[model samples]
Target: MQPGTFELLILIFIFLGLQAWWIIPIINKNNKFNKRGKDLREEIKQLEKLYKK
Candidate 1:
């Protein structure tokens, strides 16, 4: 395989992995709120749970 092609593939994978790392948790938090509603205390508790873990 060509070195340039391999490097391009690695770059693409890194970009996608970084995007998921940043976006997935926000999506999950939003989903949690969708299930729990606009409860500030609940969100705070959730954040605490994650921090403890």
Candidate 2:
């Protein structure tokens, strides 16, 4: 059986929403890690400076 226009629209919306829901958290997690990475690098640099001094 062929789907009607309304049914197709609903399916597309659902698929897009589900994709966003799954993808958004991963994007946010990567953003958090990226922010932390800078801090970690700074701390490592400080440690190296202390060791060299």
Against the true structure, what is every candidate's RMSD?
11.3, 2.8
TM-score of 1: 0.64
Clashing pairs for model 2 are none
Worst 10 residues of 2 by lDDT: 1-10
TM-score of each: 0.64, 0.80
* Model 1 spans with C-alpha error above 4 angstroms: 1-3, 38-53
Please write out the lDDT profile of model 2 over residues 13-49, one tens digit for every residue: 9999999999999999999999999999999999999
Candidate 2 Cα lDDT to native:
0.96
**Model 1: per-residue lDDT, tens digit, 6-50?**
899999999999999999999999999887775777899899999
| Whole-model lDDT per candidate | 0.91, 0.96
